[model samples]
Target: MPEQVRISLDAMGGDHAPDMVVAGAEIALKRLPHLKFLMYGDQARIKPLLDNCPELAAVTEIRHATQEVTMDDKPSVALRQRRDSSMRLAINAVKEGDAQGVVSAGNTGALMAMAKFVLKTLPGIDRPAIATYMPTQRGETIMLDLGANIECNEDNLVQFALLGEVFARVLYGIEKPSVGLLNVGIEELKGNESVKKAASILREIDLPIQFAGFVEGDDLAKGTVDVIVTDGFTGNVALKTAEGTARLLVHFLRETFRSSFWAKIGYLLARRSLQRFRERMDPRRYNGAMLLGLNGIAVKSHGGTDALGFSNAIGVCHDLIANRLNETIKAEIASFEAEMSKAEAKNPDNVPEDTAQ
Candidate 1:
């Protein structure tokens, strides 16, 4: 028999709480047969929605919690004080082994804070970083520390690169994924002290990953590298900027095409291709962000995600569970630790120093 994946979803989280959350859960259950969802929130509101779709009742189990953690509450306070918050309960399900993973579209800070407290980090990993998959010219590149840890060190960047490589290989099916340190310049001598030191450490690491030197902001959408590693601050800025640019460009395209009859006719003539382009560039298709270097799987979705976006996140969670991504990451990290230890023993004084403050 195949392994069953039970996911705990915080139904009351997100801007479209309960409604979109419920709808996404329904879509996931209908599309994926092996998925079992534990919806955590008030039962009264969720039941009516479930009643509208009787068939989903069989696959989804509701764990009622009266209170909810709003996006405004501090994550630390919410985690400690709100014992019955839906987000906390959902994470508890994963921590207690009642569910394989937890998915939420709540406050990003609170979710990260709660996740760190509940799931903890894998061995040899100091912190877990938020990683997202971006479509690049080369294919899909894994961008790490998107917003998880704003202040990171050279050690963090190196570890992020390793984790990103493993994720790309497992999730994207890229063998020996080329790794690049996000920097202001492509030259080896560019960037701050941290990036410079991280590049050196990466060069010394003997792993299956192919270190592709430094990459710039323009290189992200151009698909110059498979995995882009940077501090959370830089990565978050780059990701948001890219997202804004993509949206602006698409908006402009739509306006241009709809402005005149000739353009509308042209759009109609190329409707299929236009739809394909939209699908490819749509951020909703890549809504899930993985909390990498964790002991267990925890996926975070955009706080404002709609039903369709949440559905995409569910599909991503399903894919990660089905592929046993956490296990694969565990093995890869272990191997990396062994390699680092051996290298350290051989050249204890020669190990590159971390430049991140």
Candidate 2:
């Protein structure tokens, strides 16, 4: 780990704007005192918040951004018109070596566009994928392509699997993490041609990954594998659906507790256990999503996250920088490419080809 991990924050990017961003920084700074911040946004709106947190202000440098990218702005429009927006400036800090990493809670598409254009993808990586870790029955599981590449072929799926594999190792300190493709069923013949071919290639590869074959949607919560890889379209839908389900469950618990006087007494008796469950299921703890395969580190904080959630997001950025994740991914990609070459040379027929494409 570096003596200091400098993070650039899009102070005006989230739903709560400077307030959430500033408070999150304050919380993160307590946990990571060596952190220095580059706060980019309208100085007028951000200064007052900083004033309230003198400790944060002491190590922070605010850069005024004239424009702000709105939540409704299209990716292309935000990239072109909001060149001086807080989101762009924060990302620019990373590209210019002014910061070790950048965090944003703004428009996801816009952030991806700006990041891809500015930082570019790592060598041998065809595209970047969105990855994050979530709690499971057994433990935390790493998943990728959560809305980065909407339509991925066998090549992209394979790359996501490799990326997810690396993420599990780096983030969880896992050795030879089990990797699975998200599918309609665990059976070999249960998916589209791309997914089937992707599974085939993964099985044939000699990489460090433990390819677990196809895993159904139900397998996600079961921790059937350490890492799950899927195209963005499917991954995004799954992610949103899971989030909604969590909220729904919470609502149901609330309603159930208030249904009767006896239920209220039961809630008081089970308060401690319920608190533990709440902490385990807290979405705030899993607020950060990494744009994997990028040359530089960039984490996307949930747009509606509060101080605690955003702070968790910042923690993620710190971990990535401290772990030298990109360097590890580069080395892994090189090895993967070498393995592919060897397999193709040894038995070309074994390597799966995308016949549909």
Full-model lDDT, candidate 1: 0.86
lDDT of 1 by residue, 1-357 (tens): 566789999999999998999888877777887788899999999989988977777778999997888889997888887679889899899899998888999888888888888889988789899999888886777899898888887888888988898888888777778999999988877788878988887788787779999999988888888889989999999999999998899889999999999999999999999899989988888899998888778889888988889988888887887888888778888888888888888889776563222
lDDT of each: 0.86, 0.92
lDDT of 1 at 4: 75
- Stretches of candidate 1 exceeding 4 Å from the true structure: 354-357
Best by lDDT: 2
Q: How do all models score by TM-score?
A: 0.95, 0.97
In TM-score terms, candidate 1 sits at 0.95
Q: On a 0 to 100 scale, what is the lDDT of residue 150 in model 2? A: 89
- Clashing residue pairs in candidate 2 are none
What's the count of clashing pairs in each model shown? 0, 0
**Candidate 2 local lDDT, 1-357, one digit each (tens):** 548889999999889988999999999999999999999999998899999999999999999999999999999999899999999999999999999999999999999999999999999888999998888999988888999898998989998988888888887889889999999988887899889999888887788889999998878888999999999999999888887898999999899999999999999999999999999999999999999999999999999999999999999999889888899999999999999899889877655453222
